[model samples]
Target chain A: MFCFIALLVFSVLGIFSATHRKFAKEAFDCVFRRITFRPCNTGFREKVRGIILVKLMKRSSFFAKVFNKYFELIAWIFFVLMIVSTFYVGRGAYNFYLYGNCNGVNEEGFCLFDPTGENNKISPVAPTCGLDTPTVDDLSLANTDLDKFFFIDNNSEDTVVFIGCYVCDFTRKAFPDIEKLLEKKKPNFYFGHLPVKHGSDFISSYDYCAREDTSGDYWKFVELMFTSDIENINDQNYLQEVVDKAGYDKSKIDECLADPETLASIEQNIFNIGNTNIYGTPLVFVNNKAIVGPKPYRVYKGFLK
Target chain B: MNIKKLRKDFYFLQKKNYIYFDNACNSLRPDCVVEKINEYYKEYPVCAGRSNYALAEKLTTDLLGVRKNIAKFISAKEDEIIFTKNTTESINLLANSLDLKEGDIVLTTDKEHNSNLIPWIKLKSKGVIHKTINSNPDNTFNIERLSKVLCPEVKLLALGMSSNLDGVSIPAKEIIDLAHKNGSLVLLDAAQSAISEKIDVKYLDVDFLAFSGHKILGPSGTGVLFGKKDLLEKLGSFLVGGSTVHSSSYDDFELADIPERFEAGLQNFSGILGLGEAIKYLEKIGLKNIQKQKLVLNEYLSNELLKIDKLHIIGPEEASRRSGIVSFYIDDIDSHQLSIMLDRSAGIMTRSGQHCVHSWFKSREVASSLRVSMSFYNTLDEVKKFVDELNNIIKILR
Candidate 1:
């Protein structure tokens, strides 16, 4: 009972000491000092100390749990954020849908009624095709958008070919010849050619494709014009290694690389035969649209109307 | 508790959608702000200066008015406030303006955001010595300990009004008064406190206060520096540009007067106009009322969160004295995973990791923490929902 009484007496005295500066300067200093400053760190002590220790200690489950705890906190925050954001977006969408999206385009073209907005009454974009496929009629239909490209075969009965620098070697060789033949067969053949290289003294054959975005890299195409090891360019394994390291998927694109003969023929046609708009070697163009040397003739040829 | 108003006010941010909780980082733009920007571009669109046209004059006047508004917000003379890009710029301006001798010491705390810490750290590296005081692991400010460290050499006592990490309020006024008694200058980083705290530079006798605009519902790329007129006049201007020159010759040039001298070049004009609007909006609501609502939310979150097992809140438990920030951690989750999961699954947003208060977190024996900060715009349903999500996350995340 005396001990309890003594404790109460000390507590009162302690409170007094804490309040009065003259009586308890040192005590105040101690509390004040305690309120400020974290203790010093050793050389090994870090702000994010023990973060890697879990991995170093091979405590996978422990690390996962620890990691998850922080993420869980983030999750709650995200949930709140998403709830707000979705509402915001949906409201905006709803307002636009109901009030009519007048931010330049008519309401009929937007995906307001269609999935991914693909079935709108407005212009449709041509579907991206594999390297060898030539479908000009599909590419330039009223169903597809042509304004964004350099060339359009809209309402034309011809096929469209997309020209790429890296496809098949055989197709590259035979493309130029086919392009000239196609142009002869149909004087009004329409095609699209991408100047992957901005400018490197090429002869112009005819009308070029309409442009969307302006060229930002003038030196990029010409930079690859002369190659020290052309074989390495076609090596799928070497390319795959690069793509893999860069985190790109190569497994899904086996067919594009498998047809080397087609690639070679296309290469030969472009560099050797049809309207040689490019200097004295591998050149390819469908009537008016063309690029010089080893370009994807199949794509360009497919675009003839 | 008022979901109706919150949902309407923040109608721009409703859910299954990503709600960004990182207001301290950058608040999501309100539609009022977005439309203001659009109106500026589509309607009264004109460059501020460099033209004698009516739009130009209006833009110029609007720009200068924002500087005046910033001064009133922090309780300073119009000429004392200089528009800056953000808090880092304001602190940098102060750091550069000061004369740092080889032996002079700058006193600061471990709770400093790197914006406040690095300028002095760099000064220390350049021969000016620095002394650091610390908060207890929980991050509270104590004045007596600071007085002990204020030797004759200590020239500046740099501090934050409220810590960015845990939102623990520092006794900024008391600390400033104490530092002045020691014949040291005090600089308050009001980045975390400005929106919530009612600052009276005259009552507190603080020499300088700095804050970012975005944290207060204003636009980014804009900030305010509030310095006493006398000190601003006494200090050297760090940025010298076309706008800051009073007169110039081939070899010699006269500098512009105080605030103009400090505000060197082209400013964020539209941002300033937006900041003025935000200030007016806050004024109509009143800081005290906002503080009250934020306090209730902070208390609700802290008390409810503490009941969960294995949870460690990083700072003070009381709601009245602290800023509306709660940083806590569960036993074993890597913070980034939770941040990502929070984004993908829960649709919530919170700041994770050390929050740039590296020294404080280290001293407190914390690896990393998750911070949930509240603004007046936030609703209690969001808080309850946050706590509920947190509970489920802690369960499965473990």
Candidate 2:
């Protein structure tokens, strides 16, 4: 009880010290008395202590005895704790005021140093792919038939292969950008459905839809799976609805789902993707240089140029 | 509890048909909370403190009324409650405002979330001492160790009321009593426990309490810091400027009273209004009922999860002790990969990672784990679906 009162009294005096020069001495005295296990000199602290003591006596003699025994010690501890917590809070607020995040980490956002840091904003400075050697022609696409993959456009000179799985949210969100890239540049963009078979069984259903949509309405199927809160993508009827919505020929989709060739092609894409050291989704390889996951439009423009 | 009726209140559950197990991260707002936020923008969009117009007066009254409701929720006076952007800021307010200097110490548990842990840990740079007591053998709070650490020298015990990682609730009342007895002030981080549990600050004799609104079906960027009025007044303002001062000259200024002294500039009026509505909704349901329902859901999830081979559940094995959360990791499968599989296969939303308690994870010698944290709106059917998906994921991935 003395501890709570001391903390309260010290706080008021501490605040008042800013305006009233005399209040600093009172604040110091309050803290000193509270810390050293001395009897609180102020009537406010004494009254609070007396009230708590009476309440303890009313409850039980044993309780009152225990309260009296630890009263000073408790007050000291409470006073010190309150003081430390106040400083700690002040420091954090200072950091937040200057750095945006409580800590100096710019990843959480709104940092004074980097205002656009949290958004993963595009850097105006041109970024290199950081590969030691340039190797676009070295990537063996001569043996592989491009038509077997979910080809968005096959006419452009520059090839931009988007290695992604439909089940992944990042990959699904990245499609609009990939679509824009294809429409603008007309790059030989192969929407490779690299269904990472090790992590998920549901990827197979997505792979099935990818293979079935030969007319390249595969993106429509991906959009349906991405947008709609469907539980099982592997459900044949549910996937068939996606295929129908994508405007794919019904019998062709069924034939593709049943075909061994479709599975072989998907396996080949995954195998190729794995060889490229692509462990995650929505990887765009523009002329064998990789740009991973939802980069801003300027990044693509930079690479395309 | 009438889950079917309660489920109707949450649009994401009813219309979207999502099995939301990510309540620990952020809860889906109910219709009333959304409506309250909308009302704030549509009805009175003016700043509460800066204006004296009729709409501004109404807005200010509504905001103040919300403040009263928040205080009532925690059994504190309105003046004691200070609004913050989130629990992180609330804790930071206490961290900055207090006059802790060299030789002072702040002791916390190993299982605290980053919000509670980081603020205190940062004080090490200022020459203030910071210490941590490890959890018990079963990963519960170690009372004996806490007692050993609690000396006259130790100033503060900053602890989470409940662990966000594995959902083990520490004995907060016992800890508070012990801290007061041993001369340490207590700060309870009620971020995870506030929504599901009943927390009366007066009953607990807690010196300080902080919690976020988003985890309680309210708007994002909303939080509360409850402090004893006297202690709050003592706290020096860290982020000052704007409406914090009453009157000012070129060099000198008088700060505002109690809560406003801490609140600084214009607040999140919309979010605060929404939080009030959210609290009203929770009160109608009763927090006791919410806690009871959570335990039932958690128990079913734990029992079903235990049957799976190669899967290890973290913290206490007892379902009741785990609160509304069940965190587990399989022997070889990556938790992030599993999270994706669960989402794609079952539409089950689960959080997977260090859970911002990286220190605890580092101590436990685990890399990552998947967590299914439920709220009252969750059903037995959802639990069954989650388990079935888990079983299927194990069968296929393994």
Candidate 3:
């Protein structure tokens, strides 16, 4: 058991040091013999034990005595700990690959791979909206009506519901990958703009009116809104220019923006998005699973049927 | 002797600050010995006794000078000293060269080092009989037992002058006399005893003696085998090469003189020069002083070690009998483990295991033992630290 632990530790240390390599080779031999049901040559174990006890004895003889007495039991404990830690490390790495966060999908915590939690970051919904921030457990796509939202029905069984705001940084970060996913998978995709950032509510209303147009240029308008400068996104003139650039009729969009029903419809869209218990922009549901931030493209594509 | 001043001569004692107790294995060389070795390589690093060039002639003169010094150290003629690799090789050379035919017997003590034991044991393949003379229960040489084994059929009485395992020396003079009386020639393995004890070959009247250079504060890979000039001339050359022969044809060769004939091939010039310097250094300090210093340190160590419970010393209880060595084993703790602990905790180097006398250990049914062999340069303070460290190890390990 001690040889097993020594093998793992010395093997890792052997990479950077030549002295440890000799011990690592000894430990490997000891382990190989032990697994074959032959008695382990006690030299390696005794040498390592003597070194440890000698070091310990200098600081405290009592501790050294205790350590020497329970050396086998301590080795067993360390072996079990090594196994458990290895399992958790393996699981963390797997989760980091699949979910973009070691803690799991839509969850945020410190990750060794992504130390700043950048993949799981989001532009939170303003407290001025009079809604409590939702926990990861509360985030769900259930009870959210998708019929009234702007969507592309591809007659595919896969459903992707993405809720974003044009002015939100995290949402803007996720836009290109989402566009790529929509183009490739062609799922029954829905786009819901909730306007989480300040001064971006009117763009949602403009988006609603543009989708109502027969030009089929709503996605282009949404892409322009996300990619454009944040300061210019809220300006009406810039918005109109973007609207024109996306090939939407200026007069028809302006008329739709002026209508009272457009405001009511945009408000209804926000209510529908809130029903998913979202507290941030760029909350995407790939079928039943909800991903909350700007995850890597593979993570979003991994959900496709 | 001023041990403090003597310790200054060894660079390792100053730099490593280790309580080096493994002197029986290899003593630390003084700066003089190291400089002598360097001098050979720096000045005349050429083949001795082979070439006619000035450098080669100078080297040949220097090598012969070393042979003379070594011979004088053991009270033998210059031609009687044959240079080999080590004590093992020296003994092997004699074992292979001796004119012992089939049914001839070789008798050795039970506590002989493998260097002495294995060479004689190997002679059995040539139809020579090898027999062991059991030592006393206290691991001392039994003269009575040796007398019983000695006879005309016993061609050689090969024995270690001192047991490296226990540091107990045989009464070489009495043993040699007894063996001669029974028509058996004696060969002494003096690897352990030659360092401190005075070995007067003329006084002891020993037929042959072997010792390693490294054990006597000299360079490794150097050893000397001293035999009577007539006896050396009578023995066949063990290894034949350039120096071993004066001239050779396709199928015939004229063997060189006694020492050169036994030396074979190119010798370790630097090591031989260093060994010569080591002998001079030993003479300056005097072997009697060295023996006295070692006994004082060993007596202190033995008395302190005896105070510990379940720790049994390997040889005689008297420290004087054990020379400079204190070999012991705890009841349950592994000697290797204890030795390692002592080294790690205090830089106290020691030897553990059978000390290459496997037959003795096997016969005693002992797993292993730790040996602390002291040298003249070692101080009383170093022995105290060793004892303290050993106690600490035993307290924790046991």
Candidate with best lDDT: 3
Candidate 3 residue pairs in backbone clash: none
- Tell me the tens digit of each residue's lDDT in model 3 across A262-288: 989888877888888887878998997
lDDT of 3 by residue, B1-398 (tens): 88889989999889976888999999999999999989888988888877999999998898899999998899999989999899999999999899999999999999888889888888778899999999889989899888877778999999899889999999999999999999889999999999888889999999999999999999999999999888998998778887888889999999988888998888899999999999999999999999999999999999998999998999899999988999998888988898899888888999888889889888988888999999999999999998877776787886
- CA lDDT of A294 in candidate 1? 33
Best by TM-score: 3
Measured by DockQ, the strongest candidate is: 3
User: For model 1, what fraction of the real interface contacts is kept?
Assistant: 0.12
lDDT, candidate 2, B209-313, per-residue tens:
999999999899999999998888788898888878888999899998878878877889999999999999989999989899989999998988888887888
In candidate 2, stretches whose alpha carbon ends up further than 4 angstroms from where it belongs are: A1-305
Displacement of residue B265 (Cα, Å) in model 3 is 4.0
Better of 2 and 3 by DockQ: 3
User: Docking quality tier of candidate 3?
Assistant: medium
- lDDT score, candidate 3: 0.89
Q: What lDDT does candidate 2 reach at residue B291?
A: 90
- Model 2 lDDT vs. the true structure? 0.76
Model 1, A142-164: lDDT tens digits are: 33222322343344454343333
Candidate 2 residue-wise lDDT, A1-305, digit = tens:
54354556555656656543344444456667778898544334433444465455446657655665676887788677877876766765665443333443222434443344432321121122674432323334444455656666566668887766655666766667777777777887676666543444445644565556666476677667666643556566777677778878877767766776766766665555455555456567777566655554545655664
The models' CA-based lDDT, in order, is 0.61, 0.76, 0.89
* Candidate 1 segments exceeding 4 Å error: A1-305, B1-3, B14-19, B47-51
